[model samples]
Target: MPIIVNLDVLLAKRNIKSKELAKIINITEANLSILKSGKAKAIRFSTLEAICEALSCQPSDILEYVKEKE
Candidate 1:
């Protein structure tokens, strides 16, 4: 996927556990795991907002775009 989810990196940089983040964001650890693994097809804006708020980060910190070589 061109869009990469960098949730794990941000979590690590903030010294936070996935379970803790999940609780802060009011989501399940399983769901957060799916997002961390880049398996989620889509993320709700509310969820994104919550993550950013919980991590004290901008959306760009959790997501990135990489152009694939043709």
Candidate 2:
């Protein structure tokens, strides 16, 4: 996928655990795992907002786009 999920990096930088982030965002650890692994097809805006708030980060901090070489 061109879009890369960088949730793990952000979590590590903030010294926050995935389980704690899940609780703060009111999401299940399983769901957060799916997102962290870049398996989620889509993310709700509300969920994104919650994550940003919990991590004290911007959306760009969690997501990135990389052009694939052709």
Candidate 3:
């Protein structure tokens, strides 16, 4: 996948644990795990907004795009 999820990096930078973040974002750890692992197919805008607010970051901080080498 070209889209890379940098959620774990941001969490570590903020010294926040996944469980705590999940609670703050009102999401389950299992779901957050899926997102952090970049395995989630899609994320709702509301969920993204909540995560950004909780982490004090922008969406770009959590998500990135890298072109795959052909």
Candidate 4:
């Protein structure tokens, strides 16, 4: 996927567990894992807001665009 999820990096930097972030973001641990693993196809704005709020970070910190190699 050209879109990369940098959530794990941020989570580690903040010393937060996936389950803890899931609870704070009001999402299931599975869903959080999906997002964290870059398996999610899409993310809602509300969900993004919740994640940002819980992580004290911006959307850019979690989502990044990577150029695909041709």
- Error (Å) of candidate 3 at residue 47 is 0.6
By descending TM-score, how would the candidates be arranged? 3, 2, 1, 4
Candidate 4 regions off by >4 Å?
Answer: none
- Candidate 3 segments exceeding 4 Å error: none
Tens digit per residue, CA lDDT, model 4, 34-61: 9989999999999999989988999999
Candidate 1 lDDT tens digits, 1-70: 9999999999899999999999999999999999999999999999999999999999999999999989
**Which ten contiguous residues of candidate 3 have the minimum total lDDT?**
20-29
Each prediction's Cα lDDT score?
A: 0.95, 0.97, 0.98, 0.94
Please give the lDDT score for candidate 4: 0.94
lDDT string for model 3 (1-70, tens) is 9999999999999999999999999999999999999999999999999999998999999999999999
Residue pairs with colliding backbones in model 1 are none
Model 3 scores a TM of 0.98
Q: On a 0 to 100 scale, what is the lDDT of residue 32 in model 4?
A: 91
> In model 4, which range of ten residues has the least summed lDDT?
18-27
lDDT of 2 by residue, 1-70 (tens): 9999999999999999999999999999999999999999999999999999998899999999999999
- Once fitted onto the true fold, the runs of candidate 2 whose alpha carbons sit more than 4 angstroms away are none
lDDT of 3 at 43: 100
lDDT of model 2, residue 61: 96
Worst 10 residues of 2 by lDDT: 52-61
What is the alpha-carbon RMSD of candidate 3 to the true structure?
A: 0.4
Best by lDDT: 3
